[model samples]
Target: MPLPAMPIETDLLLAHLNGQRQHVLGILDGLDEDALRRPVLPSGWSCLGLVRHLTEDVERFWFRCVMGGEPTAIVALSQGTEAWQVDPDVPAAVVLDRYRQEIDRANAVLAGTPLDAPPAWWPPDQLGDWRLASAREVILHVITETACHAGHLDAVRELIDGRTWLVITT
Candidate 1:
């Protein structure tokens, strides 16, 4: 896909960053609770779990880390000691909507901010007199974080069913 454009073309970095989100969207789109909550491999991570993790991650890293100047102390709720604590009572629909919306919000922030804009969360040195990153770096950060999750989601998706993202033509 050519990528969806806003009023401005933020450049290749943003496009690449958005691509990772698109990858995640592909993993999420058609899943229901049965498919989303199914376990994969050695860990207990599920499609829904992955979405939750990504949603929090996107907010912490993109919205907080970059835009709001906050920290990323929030860990994945499904990881390590907390793995077994996920509330089974939670509905998949709510989780999915929240995840999708957070991702869209992150995209909106990236689109609205200039690539060279200084994120409130950046280190003081980086945000110094001539601070602010090249638009490419911010997008690159988003891409790297999101792509790793996308990879994990892809595997989780495959484990849930037999689907591979590459297998679908559309």
Candidate 2:
């Protein structure tokens, strides 16, 4: 999706997020399994690690945290190491697939619920802070998170092989 140069909502936010997704997708495309899993930075964070983390983060916000209470006990703890070892034995491709699944689920939940519908999950105190958000706000948070991680992945790509960011879609 083509993104706008301005900071407007709706189209701008959606377009920007689509752009970020494209950017990350580009970084992942045409890479071997090793390349995808390789640590491209000094801290050993790989493209796969960032993808997994972003997926989980957004899932928490949009699905469990934003909509309801924590559904599972599997919490993400970043050690900033090679491949991020979420479940050390899992492969990069597996993590990426999990991310894709979570994103779809989160999107569906967000699309089905109204923005003003009271969140089913947060604590009473947290409720006050979140009570007023529209669905737009929730989506904006997702976009912001995705864009931030896309930038991180871009830097990792550059570090790995001096790759530059180019538009993925016109």
Candidate 3:
């Protein structure tokens, strides 16, 4: 179990980050196999695909990209496009569980690290500038990105089953 919460900005940011993550995953709560696989748009990204994408995204961005250093292994290998592609063999349940697990791992990283630590790896452009990103910067970026994806998940969930879970409910 998580220790007692800190009454500070880090806690607030993490709360919002985890909330957005949970919000996106919650969209698939009652969905069946076929329903989860149903495409929200003609482009062919199903609801399951979005969850899987977020799984990789959160893990890759927060844990790997920020915590491990910039341009982590996933980025070196796939350059961020891999998350958008869904594996046909993997089941939706596994994808959902993975997202949940990723979130837990991310929270642990956030909890153990300080917000003021500078990134281990800085982009070439930010090397000498005043824009070096601290752990706090990465955390905020993840929160914002997750929230944006949650909006996408909202539209996809509605298109799939007409349930507007992002705004009206969990």
User: Which candidate wins on TM-score?
Assistant: 3
* lDDT tens digits, residue span 1-170, model 2: 33224324544555666677677777777666677778776767667777777766565555655565444623553334422544558776788778777766665565455555555554346335645355566666777778787878777777767776865776
Q: For residues 12-83, could you state the per-residue lDDT of candidate 1 as single tens digits?
A: 666776677789878766887777777765666667766676677555555645675545544443335352
Best by lDDT: 3
lDDT for 87 in candidate 1 is 65
Sorted by TM-score (best first), the order is: 3, 2, 1
| After superposition, candidate 1 runs with Cα above 4 Å error | 1-11, 70-86, 122-135, 168-170
**lDDT of each residue in 1-170, candidate 3, tens digit only:** 75655549888888788788778878668989888877667677777777777777556655655576646434322244466666778887888887887777667766766788776654455335655367788888777878887888787777777888735555
**Which of 2 and 3 is ahead in lDDT?**
3
* Alpha-carbon lDDT, every model: 0.65, 0.63, 0.71
- Worst 10-residue lDDT window, candidate 3: 72-81
Clashing pairs in 1: 69-121, 115-135
